[model samples]
Target chain A: MKRMSMTMVIVLLLIPMALFARGVSEDVTTLTIAGRDGAYGDAMELAIQSYTAKNPNVRFELLKLSGSELMEQSVIELRGGTGAFDVILIDDPFLTQLQEAGWLADLDALYRKKGVAIDPDLVENMVNIGRYPYPNGPLYALPHVGNVALFAYRQDVSRKYGIEKFDTWSQVLDVAKKIKANEPGMAPILFRGVQGNPIVTGFLPIYWAFGADILKDGKPAFDTPEALNALEYFLELAKYAPQGVTAYQATQVSDALLSGVGAIAIEVWPGWIGNLENPELSNVVGKVKIAAHPGEVKRSSSMIGAWMVAIPKDSKNIDAAFDFLLHLTSAETQAMISEKNGVPPTRHSVHKISSLVAMYPWYPAQLDGQISGSIRPRTNYWAEIESVFGDYLQRALVGNLTAKAALEQIQRRVTEIIER
Target chain B: MRNRERAVYSSFFYIVFAPALLIILLLTTYPMVTILYDSFFRYSFVVNTRTFVGLGNYIHIVGEELFQRSLINTLVFTLVASFSEVVLGVALAFLLKRQFLGKRVASLIVIFPMIISTMVICAVWQIFYHYEIGLFNHVLTTLGMQRVGWLTDQRVALASIILVDLWQWTPFAFLIIQAGMGSIPSEIFEAAQIDGARSGQIAVKVTLPILRNQILLVLMLRTLDTFRLFDKVYALTGGGPANATQTLSFFIYREGFKFFNFGRASAASVITLVGVAFLALFYVRRLLGEEE
Candidate 1:
């Protein structure tokens, strides 16, 4: 009995010291990254796997969250002065807000201290979005996802409609009508109907092509004759849309394309179109041609939806976070992520990679779109204005109000938001 | 001699209760105080700036078209959905009170919706409410009727959301009413019948009277809950087909969480809080008056 008691006491005494050693090591080497879910999440996983393999002692805790959830958590945590996250993922639309609030550390300062510069392959426009005051503003983030919206059409179907090249919104509509008439089950056009970002992004090309600007001198420019014509044309084209088109979101549009039910998709982001050429995953593989949006009043209008990586201003491990950021945006890491996780590459070099090109035949189109894409007006009220426009636009689409009525309503509501 | 012991025991009681009381006070009162404080500021989330501007946010919110529409939408949704839930719940509970074949299966099916998460339920219902190939439209077309734009029509979008809420949450009220009904003895019904009262008469005179408090309780609970409708609007219509389905919670979510305009969001929230408080206090006072 005495010996057993003595052994038990020895075991108890050793456990605390072991725990102390483990805790001490854990405090120093671990990196916490807040990234997005979906394809972006997959990309982060690949980067982390590669980074950890190189440095065995270093580890990571990745929070894979939805876009809105990631933004809210980053803001709340950073504002609360919790240096809990070393790196954060931000949507392009929220970059201005993050930059203005100083939630993100200045990447230029980090680079100067590290004696390194941002890699040249990352596009200038993409890098510019990560800055405050934009363009020549201080670098605060890096482009992680090069999301630019492109147009997609079935090669065979477009031929049947005798639509050789879409140069105008009117031509696209003409093609859509012909496709619907010729093809019985296939929808001529499909767009995201799930409201907010989906609907707003889907309509942006048409809105821009109509020669209507979203903002003019810090005021809503939606109340115009061009905007009205665009709405009418959109509604006219809606006749050929599927019956439940109002409720159609990204999943529905993608499903419509993959199942051979949709001939033309007006808005196809890189993330959603990455799997289009995979025969096992797609029914219409190798049959679709993707291009930038057709131009009308101006040049082809493409919208950028870049997702960026930024270190919160309150980060405890800014040095380690910048190290991970560099590794994540490396050409080597980008290529691996494209291959394994199907994250759309942001760098120009990745598009030239033979393997990735083979994976996405639309890589050339996506590249062109990114090169010439027009980003949404970077107003602080973009979120509110987008909501207002999307709501009324759908209202008109559903025949709840006339185009005139809808535009007037949106104008009145948006005027107040901008005025404030 | 034991006075010192009594003092120690009293101190222990204070120590134990103090923490819980403090926590409750912070949880319940802190948010309310913050909202009240923030409503007076011109809050800009991007600038990370707040300025004192008394009644400015309130004036802005009340003057905005979107806010006005959302207020009306919330008020209508709360009254209609809550009343319907209570009436339907009580009706179902009355019918379910008796023993019958397949009663167990019926009960299970009735409670199935409440078991699922709101997002999942909204997804399923969204498909059902689809205009082209939805189950609801499918049924209508099969009967040689015109297809109704269930969610696309602004006039009907709010009503459609209420319909979905009813489907998912009626079971909650039903369960509550059923528990309340079970507590009333069989002897009460027997005695009423022994006095030559018909089943209908017994239900009207006795069963309803006994279940009045439960019905009111469910109504009060559901009214307050429905007043904050958000998830369904988000998943389904997104306050679209016009601002026909915007609710107070959605307004606050947009201004606060989405845009981080703390002042405006707080102003909107305070209005809702005041409205809900008025209703809750009314019901509580009525309950207390009945007791008195």
Candidate 2:
């Protein structure tokens, strides 16, 4: 009796395994994608629904994760050669690391196999970010989100102060000072001042505009005079920022802008300020102007923070994933996603659509930033460099370290990271 | 016949316990050994490089100023938070020892924070800590005082987090101590009363002496838990305002997951583990001495 029962259990387990094998051999194809959450996830869901409707035989398993979670999971799966994820989203900064590791599929070969030329509708600068050895290399991913950091200010406030336009960092500082002295109830300036990524990203445009490169000829340039000037200027401007700004994030900055409590924001992202035109959500609707950051020693230098989609080299459904990738980035799909979800589109035609441009009044400025913005230095150690630089920068902002001392410390740490 | 039965029992014991013992070894011992081994190398996930550099990772991590700050912050948090929680827990336990009207409902209310999720608690507190619109600042404004930077001020951020921890975990210590108090014989208190002992004297001389083991256990658990502080700092401050709240676990997380520098992260983790073990040993020794 015992032997018979054991045999029964064995057969029951094997039966499911046999059925699963048969199911895999059948015609149905399931493509697994590791993507982002929030509005990006909603956009991916819309695309998936549209594609599966057109191709009835294809199915999808979408894993919506946060940015850091997506990177960690994708890296682990790719490194293990699990063939678990067919498609994955890579944050622009992490693209260099993944591409350099040779974990991503070669999109150039896939394009050749499909006998289709890369579409020019896609913005050239956005597409260039997906290539390793950067500006020119084998294509391994396609731009999905055309995110760029821009400056925002209350147009009415600026007009009241008799400032027509802010063309220089000095002008911005002057306006901030005036707003602080005049408007006692409103915050003069706003930006994410939290340590790590928030503070680093907010500071980059000013740093670049002041002519300080994080890496010059593959070495740390933070100890230079330009860096010192930028940090000093930032410290001066920070005095006008909201109290407890060191804990501020995107939500806080956007809240301050939308509520008409902030007169100017030194840093704003396309995703964060998408509702600025809606009066229901924003009290400052049509009252705020978004533009490229003001220049100091150079022209306005915006920072590109795009998100890209790629296929893993060990994917089981690479062919189907490539087809979905193309469909996902096509002008029509981009337009649909952008109109419905307010996700920044990567295609020029989509950005030029009259309906989208009407909804997002800053489309022209966004597209301009995308075309002429600066990408962070392409280095595998960008994450470490950003963290170290942010720590010291926040220290200076909070009066814990002098600006020159902060720059010196950042220079020393970044040099150590690169050497390691 | 007895010998044969003994042999059979021993065989059955091995058969029943082998799988569990093996699983424990795999889950605990395996990773610990692996971490120890990895600490001696320079492992970069991006470059896919693993270079053996004995003692180099430990030396480098120990020499880092941030690591030193994180260690000191962790120690301060553990000592202050854990000590406060245990003392408050014992006080509450004594207060509730005698039954009164609404005692059951009061106990439930006191333990509410412990039952709720930490993330949810953090979200609620984040709003309460907001500079301009928080409840505390509103009260302060109404009272004609200045608003405080709860999470942004370096000097006060760690204390704010400790308040949150004490609010959430004191009930856990209370529950354990209360149970221990219940298990003690009531006759001892009556006997002390017959000898003219006051309530305060009885609590100090009789009750506390009897609850030594329980209090020590609570201290040990709370200390070990608080020593590895991560979630509160991650959600509240991100170790900001000049790294005032940066703890060892946050440092290890940044090094290991954010940067994927396994060797340095492993070394940091081993050091933290040793520190926690030492703390646990101190409490355990106290408990054992009380028993003796």
Candidate 3:
């Protein structure tokens, strides 16, 4: 009886083994993509739904994750030479790291192997973000999302505040102060205050507007007077900001803007502000104007935060992966995401589409922003430097440190990181 | 003939232990060795090149003021949080030892936090800690007091996280002590009461003496666990408001995962390993003394 039972257990295990073998890929099968969450994920899902209809055999396993989680997992699997993921998505901030590490398969080489040049409708500036020593370098990925930091304000309110021309940070700050005093029970300004990328990205345009470079001659120069003045200006503007602004993330800031509780959003991303014009989403429709940031000591400086798609270096199904990637970033798909879901397009031509422009008023401004926006410093120490700077900057904003002292302390630590 | 028997016994034990021992060596010892070896180099995930630096990473981490502050913050949090947990846990366990109106239900409620995941706990606590919308600030506001920046203020952020840790883990220490107390014969306590000893006298003399080993065990375990505080800081604050809550694990994670500066991360890990090892040694000594 015991021998019979043991035999039955062994057979049960073998049955499952047979079922597992049933998971074997067909000669033409599905492509698995590890992409990002939020609107980007929605955009990918929408594109996949449409693409799968035409090519019914091609199924998809789309893993939508946060930016940080996606990067960590991709690196771990790629480094371990696990070919589980066919195609992977990366934030542009990490492109420099991933591409430089040789973790991503070179797309140019892949294109040559497939005997094709590349997808053409993709905007050159957005496409260039996928390259190492970006803008004129080896292509390792394809831009999936063309995101830029833009300024948004209540257009009618700005007019009432006599802020007819928003050309400089000083003008925006002055208008914000008046709006604070005159506009009762409403936040005059709003921005992300979460540390790391949110706060740093929000502050960058203003910093650049003050002619303060995050890096100078390939080294940290945050201790300079320009950076100090920029931080002081940031603090001055924060005086008129919403209470509890220090804890604001993208969601809070957007909720405030969309609910008509705030006047100016110092920094707005296309993905978060996508439904601005939809009455279903926004309490105040067509009131907020999304455009390039008001420039100060420098010309309008927008920060580019594009999402790029690439095959891992260890991908077993490279051909299948590249197929999905091409389909994923195609003009039709880009236009569809833009029109249907407001997933911002990386391609200029897609943005220029009449139907798309009708849906998103910021498309023209977005295109201009993408073409001219500045990418964050690509140093391996960018994460560390940003954290240190963001922390001290928040301290200054919260009145824990004077702007000068904050800059001086950050300058010392930032230099040390750069030197390392 | 005696040596032959001893040799045979040793071989038999080794044969029994070999597979399990090898698993430990592979899983635990291998990672330790790797981190230790990597600490001597400048490791970059971006470059994928490792250059020998001979303590350069350690020197660099030490020179960074944030690292120093994180070390102090982690140490203070570990000592304060763990000590309070053991004391409070013992007290609660002792209080609940008797038959009460809803003893079973009360016990379940107390151990509820231990079953829940730390991430879930952090999520709940984050809502509670929010300055404007959180229940904590709301309570303060209702009482006609100024709202507090529970997670934003550098002075209070780490302590607020500590409160969350204590809440989630005091139950663990309580359960262990309760079990230890249950195993002790009730006759000892009955005899103490027969001698007309006061409740306080019996607790100080009998209950504490018996629970001493269990308390020590809880202390060691809690200390080791609390030292590796990463998730709370990650989910709640991300070690913000000026490195106030930056623990050693977070420091390593930032360097290793975020920056891919594995060498520096390895250095930080080695420093942590040494600290934990010292703690382990202290516990072992206490354990030995108690056993004797």
In order, the TM-score of chain B in each prediction is: 0.94, 0.95, 0.98
The DockQ values of the predictions, listed in order, are 0.53, 0.72, 0.49
- TM-score head-to-head 1 vs 2, winner: 2
Candidate 2 per-residue lDDT over residues A36-65, each given as its tens digit = 999999999999999989987799999999
The TM-scores, one per candidate, come to: 0.93, 0.96, 0.93
DockQ of 1: 0.53
Model 3 stretches with alpha carbons more than 4 Å out? A1-26, A109-120, B1-3
lDDT score at residue B55, model 2, on the 0-100 scale: 96
User: Which prediction has more favorable TM-score, 2 or 3?
Assistant: 2
Better of 1 and 3 by DockQ: 1
Candidate 2 positional error at A345, Å: 0.5
lDDT of 3: 0.86
**Candidate 3 displacement at residue A54 in angstroms:** 2.6
CA lDDT, candidate 1, residue A82: 89
| Best prediction by DockQ | 2
lDDT of each: 0.86, 0.92, 0.86
- The DockQ for candidate 3, computed on C-alphas, is 0.49
lDDT string, candidate 1, A251-321, tens digits = 88988888888988989887887678888889998888888899888778789998889998888888888
Deviation of model 1 at B126, angstroms: 2.8
